[model samples]
Target: MKPASKSPSLKCLFLVAALAVWPLPAALAQPQGESFSGYLQTVAAKARREGISETAITRTLSGLTPNQRVIELDSAQPGSQGGPPPMAPYIARHVGPSIVSRGRGRHAELSGVIRKVEARYGVPGPVLLAIWGHETNYGSYVGDFDLARSLATLAWEGRRRDLFEGELIALLKMVDRGVPSYKLKGSWAGAFGYPQFLPSVYLRLAVDGDGDGHADIFSSPSDTLASIANYFRDAGWRQGQPWGVRASVPSGFNVGAYSTRLTAPRCERVHERHSRWKSVSEWRALGVAPMAPIGGDVLASLFQPDGPGTPAYLLTGNYRVILQYNCSNYYALSVGLLADEIAR
Candidate 1:
């Protein structure tokens, strides 16, 4: 009989190949000393494979080097080192009087266009303004980083390679579509324009609200508002429904019994603080009455961020939709509260 074969089985071979190319976890240090030029070559090859125009790749990627500032900013992002800061303080800073005043002014100033967009997309005008106000302070400062350099540097850093790499490719495709190079400036994280959209988001949802046939979110307030409405609509913002309402929780009610057992795949920590979904009437029976009107049968979750005697809320599905935009309770709540203030 022949000796047993030494070659590995097909399944073993496949597993070995997979392991060779698998990515390291974000917590682990990336392999060092890879040439940035060589990394760009691979990205260019990917662009070509994805059918990005050679002219676009050559024009945008040529002579580009990794941005050290982008790497520095990325490293400084908040992680698991400490407990989160208080929501009361964050809300005070982000949704302060200045933002509220500006938000109402913009709401009134753009009322005509806002009405049109709201009619088309089923998103409220004040909600759109709230997002705009929060994103870039109503376009006062939309960052000044070169998006190509920022995206490439972040990708090269390898902490979030797949995400930033895909964004870089999308940026090249934007170039292919004739967006000017100078217009490709935004946050150090590659989000650009008045709405602070990533390249992919711009490609997918940006629309021309002014009938110019060009979706210029960089300088056009109408386009920015319209694009934000489109994003909210896509995220399932329910028209004619409130995002949430403040609640009066009884002193003896055990909020902990209603804590959500389901873990969210993304932003699990943020979602963990939310109570289980219950109908508005059911919550009313439990002595958690909404201060403002909400439909009796509507499903909502309870959020009591600061414990007893602090402000509480009954959040609707629209609140979850807002979370999809930024994934922070403080952000979503501030947006809702800001929208209410602007509407008033």
Candidate 2:
């Protein structure tokens, strides 16, 4: 449930990625005639089958042109793109002092709202704030891409048409449900609001935290915080537990024996990087121990992002929940570490 942001966000923010706004084909551009128009018609018909009103479709989706930039970004994805660097360097950059400092400040400013959300959702304030800071820089830069256009363009490009088309239908549904076209601005890939819920995610989990009758994540910081917490709560964030803690893996430890055999459909590669589920006590018996606080007996898995020499982690189920938000080990680790610093 992450979105593309004006800036990079942590919650699967990197998981979702972003697009560009470059010029499309001279003739196929401008939401009008030719293949682009035909594609719109095809999607609009599908939307009709899905129960979107014709009027709403005509108003929001007619004459749409493909975005070349969205295509470029979508093509340049993680494995497709040159892939990211090692875990430690990426984590260090993502959870640096500036982000942590801003997160702490935002935490203080929204202390009242954080407390309220935690009271209602059983999610800690620091975790939510860290997500906020990572996604859209505490709402300072939630991208300016026209969501309809971005999703539409990605759909037309046809790389991952089924996925983008579904998102397009959801955005049209949002328009039908009275979300203004103007407010539908977000990441080039269709993540919106301070917390960056996709259109579908918004429909399922967005809440009215500000008591304003509207779950206005775009304008209401209160709602954004609550929505983020609610997302984690639904994603299985433990109420009174830390996400995970650093651990030391003994030299020459048999990593292959503990490797995960189960494969998750979503983020399969990310899940593949983790070790099999083992309780903290089991990990301790195997010569792995936490550097920070973690309860014994919790189900955890081993992860050594930088091979044998670098730091290792005994990631808990809550860490798995963080991955549900984005599904990247680096992203999940950064979020946990950032929340730690904010609380400090």
Candidate 3:
């Protein structure tokens, strides 16, 4: 019927084959010979389809350059200091008296807010204070790299394209929503603001705590604390539980046998410092006593940062949440211990 119609599927396949064999147009092949202005036009078109305004796109991408330093810093690992330095040396450099003193001062200044934050998120004031202290020295040392430019450069370079592209889009959205470009400055690794949030985290967890329309972590103490609390809450922070408590391991306990052998999916190095997890009751049966009285039922794991004979701890699930922010056992432990000291 009707001259034995050629198969429609066969025609589609032929079309696909032809297209595959054909060379792409020069404009579509690579980002070649396009002036920055022309590139901006294409990016703006894409942004518009994604609901970003032209003004926002212009403001964010104008005068942007790829940050070579950001790429370099991103590739560098944390403990690449030739020989592994002792825990005390690392802690001294990161969690010094200055951080503790400032954390104490910030705690005093934000006592009422911290109490509200604790009531809402179940994370303690000092723990939050410690994170604030560690991330950016309580806002005193928030980074100076241009966030929009850095994210854009990372996206264009296309190494971690999926991750950085999404972040770059988020940065455009931030600019569209009235966050000034100057305020978009942050760390070389793309974490920004007073609490050192990545663009994605800021989009998800930042809060307008002071009733201000903007969630300005850089200048607003209330917003920073609220944002930190929000992050912990989102990361499964349980209310009324201590992160971890100091504990004494029993004599003759096989420290090497119980040490963590498996690498964590995230925060592998941090997890390596701690012994394997066991329920609190199990630890207690093995002669582990809470170094400090902690309220509520909490499942915890044993940790000895400086091996078995050092200051040991029984860390709770909340401690793991802190590790999600920065996967360093030393960092999380210092934050927790410092927070406890400040509270005392």
Candidate 4:
């Protein structure tokens, strides 16, 4: 047997040199490196040792160029000044008559699959429909980036290496398990299919609702709904409870005393919009009544998304479950409101 060749010591040295001499625009250039070729070969060898097939490796990596846009977007976190528009403005723009009309139409079209999903998962069909509407605008805009290429590029960039590396590996595993590369396209951030699931999420929660061998979220509404239901179930969705309801806040309601003293474990921004958890009875005593009736023994929290003076809400645990989807109060609230509308 041949002795193993000693690995090169200064792997990053050439990269550093390339960065120093290369102009900014040139650095953003397409694939152009014999040195990078060596690195990739070494990586391929390691992957092969770990049981990844040569064919899979070659196919997964063929024609991959470092995506400059991904690098730029990953580095540029949205600043406070340039952050998303306020809730009202954003709602006006995105949740208007046209969107609602289209959503209602889609809701009618997918009613059968939605009903089956809801029956199986105990989540309301309209609620799932509302989320589908909000996330991808009823499948009208599910992004257009190649999931593997984007994730691989982000993984190799070394800035958010840990995060994207995991996603890249998951993407490879997805291919290895038989998801066609052509069907693996999604958002620039690697969120894919009708429900915009991350690669890890797809592995864990994707379902073949139509009883086919594969979970085709890209094209199958049944699979998409089932996958979403599975996601919500995994995220602790409670059966037979309302997520939340809009309510009128009474006069002289003390906003100061209603604030949460502790931070939530996840989706802090969404939870921050809510007051500390209190029983529905306590809330009712404080002149907060649900605009819609809630049945059975449902534990609820009080929330005023636009502070105390505006409309308040009585939120159940299911509302927090919705937060797991997007981690935004506006998103959860909109889903709830839209579901109510659709149900009505």
TM-score of 2: 0.87
TM-score of model 4 (CA atoms): 0.83
Q: Each candidate's root-mean-square deviation in Å?
A: 10.2, 8.5, 10.3, 6.6
Writing each residue's lDDT as its tens digit, candidate 4 over 111-206 gives 887778888988887777778788888777888888877877666666566787667666766776778988888888889888998887888889
Q: Where does model 2 exceed 4 Å of error?
A: 1-34, 80-84
- Against the reference, the lDDT scores of all candidates come to 0.86, 0.80, 0.73, 0.73
TM-score of each: 0.90, 0.87, 0.81, 0.83
Question: For model 2, which pairs clash?
Answer: 3-191, 4-187, 6-143, 12-326, 31-63, 31-64
Candidate 1's C-alpha runs over 4 A off are: 1-32
Pick by lDDT: which candidate is best? 1
Better of 3 and 4 by lDDT: 3
In model 4, which runs have C-alpha deviations exceeding 4 angstroms?
Answer: 1-25, 29-50, 80-85
Whole-model lDDT, candidate 1? 0.86
Q: For model 2, how does the per-residue alpha-carbon lDDT over 171-191 read when each residue is reduced to its tens digit?
A: 887877778878989898989
- Give the range of the ten consecutive residues with the poorest summed lDDT in model 4: 1-10
Rank list by TM-score: 1, 2, 4, 3
Clashes of 1: 0
